[model samples]
Target: MTGSRGPAAASAWIPLVVTVTLVQAVLALMSRALPLFGMPLTASSGMPPEAVGQLSSATSLGSMLFFLWGPALLVRLPSIRQLQLGCAVSAAAMLFCAAGRWEGLLIAAFGIGLGYGPSTPAGSDLLMRVTPKHLRATVFSIKQAGVPLGGLAAGLLLPAVAAFFGGVDAALVTAAVLALVAAAALGFWKGTVDDARPAASAASPFRHLLLAPVRLIGLLVHAPRLRLITAAGFCLGVAQGVLMGFFPVFLSDHAGWSLTAAGAAFAVLQGLGVGGRVVMGWMSDRLGDPVRALSGICLASGLTMALLASIGPGSSPLWVIVLSSLAGLTVVSWNGVFLTGLAEAAPEGRVGEITAGGTFVLFSGYVVCPLLMQAVIAATGGYAIGLILAGLAPAIAGLALMIGAGRRQR
Candidate 1:
């Protein structure tokens, strides 16, 4: 089922909320850990800082591959089982990463990302069954807020742990322990949460794999709402990719901010993003239309990015903080609203599969847009042109959605 309108007892969906939220947090911690600990991690691993980014790229590639093929696995494994497996894989990846060898880090990064692949589709599958339609955006946003919280933990806790415990290995081990404990804890909730099983398929896994891309394309082609939202998601991903992936670097290298100052600005952006998700969720619920909420978000995000791209050495620090806060409020906060709309648009019995397909497109933006941005930067010898293009993508998408909504109303 997509969603229902009646009020639901908290008991019916609260457990699902907790389960999915915890899973999101774990995934965020694992992925964000690499960037936060990059200096020490690269130094200890005997890899250059630039080379460490390749590991992150590897992780994204792994996630995209799994998302493409996830529906096949969903036919056999319940969402709860998927979550458990994701956590377990992440735990193992962390341990492997602790080896501090280049080859090991490459494998571990990809493994952790593969583990993260199921997070949205699986979580949405579980939540949509129990969560009321009225409360859908709020609930999903609450779960997604765990991402910013996990990132906050990475920024605040990991550095301290590394400092007190003597190095990067201790921090890696600490993250691994958390993943294992989360996996074990999930086992208790399995029977209760895995109430809905995916319909079984007669096709072999190989056959299913072969058909995955075709199936996803067919879904998008048939579902107009899903296609629109998926495209918007890709555009939004470009802005988000630029901000989260390169914001600090931009502030330090282009804007002439100190490393500590740049890091503080980043924290402001991420910290405010937690509250932003919740607020955006409430707005979406009140508006009774996730699309409108997302349109506004994209517009705001584009505005913020444009403003940020204009900042340079002589710009005021207060202005930088303001822009960062706005970026956090819009760019990072759009995910929950976007995901809720995607879940609502999903056809019956195919929420997980459709979500996997949509996310695959969205993840493609994260992987591809930055490369384009780099090319723009190389050609222009300045950051402004690239950032402007990033902002323009979402602006155009938001305007298109708004116009489309208007025509439909007419």
Candidate 2:
């Protein structure tokens, strides 16, 4: 095990990390594209702006379905090949979006999400094999940073491309081209990375697909460590989803900030989130306990989110900016550490299965919590109650994790 951390190992893991990061970044960009371009897209499609929500729902539906069956695909295809197929599907979907109408947008959004689904489990499968145990958390953090990186690129570059070509279609086309190019580039590494794929299952592929989610849930149910981390993932993911999904809206509605200012603050939060992931990962490595790092993050997230909920129109921009940055560090930065813990606890030869299952659990928070937040806002006619409850979730989870660890030690 010690010898596996040598220069030869470095040679392998470094490229794998870079490759996985690239895939993650591309997936993130594709997931965000339609929403970012919604104004122009809806205008041209003769649909109301609210239709974007329908498109988003379609995409989320596609992604959840893929998460359920992702492991079955891994059983038949190597992780790299799965990634390539996903990219190809995304590229074609983007093309459809660029060329077609409202119906096309709905179909394309779902396709893009389906294509994005392979990223976590497949990337984890590749990286877990080569990453050194000592550096696992930090490396995973670095790769996870690609998500924010992709968001940044979409923010800066997509608008420019849309403006330069005089339409959103150009932006869509450019993204499609990038996905296709990424797929082609990965081909060069397939021979190197695909050698360790599990033997193709002899069972019926459709049967295996239908049972994948059930099997994954069973794996999670029996593993106490996985169960704990999955709960943490869900709680933290709620905080994250609430922050990202509603931060700008909350600032505009309650904090009395202009939409532009709110967006700028949101960007600051996202930018800081990138740094937070790396820092937390490094801390996990130093502490030799990713769970401790996650606990601390959740605690901090709870505090900052509570403070954020209290800000009103009269609040200073400095307070809003500072709190948003803190939210980035706490709310948006937990994924890598959560994933590190997940990979570490996964059964041997079952990392992909466990990752897919855990991801499904975590992602459910993203779906359910936002709706809950909306409900709170509707009932109370204010954002504060919803935001505070969101903050409280991770705080409790963090305390629970701390107590659980202490009990295990005793």
Q: 54-139 in candidate 2: lDDT tens per residue?
A: 56556666777778886686676888898898899888888778565899888898898789888888888888877878988998
Top of the candidates by TM-score: 1
Score residue 305 of candidate 2 by CA lDDT.
81
Regions of candidate 1 where Cα sits further than 4 Å from its true position = 1-10, 39-53, 99-103, 252-264, 311-317, 376-382
Q: Model 2 segments beyond 4 Å from truth? A: 1-9, 37-57, 95-106, 248-263, 310-317, 378-382
Q: What is the model-wide C-alpha lDDT for candidate 2?
A: 0.78
Candidates in order have lDDT scores of 0.78, 0.78
Worst 10 residues of 2 by lDDT: 1-10
- Model 1 Cα shift for residue 307 (angstroms): 2.1
Estimated TM-score per prediction? Answer: 0.89, 0.87
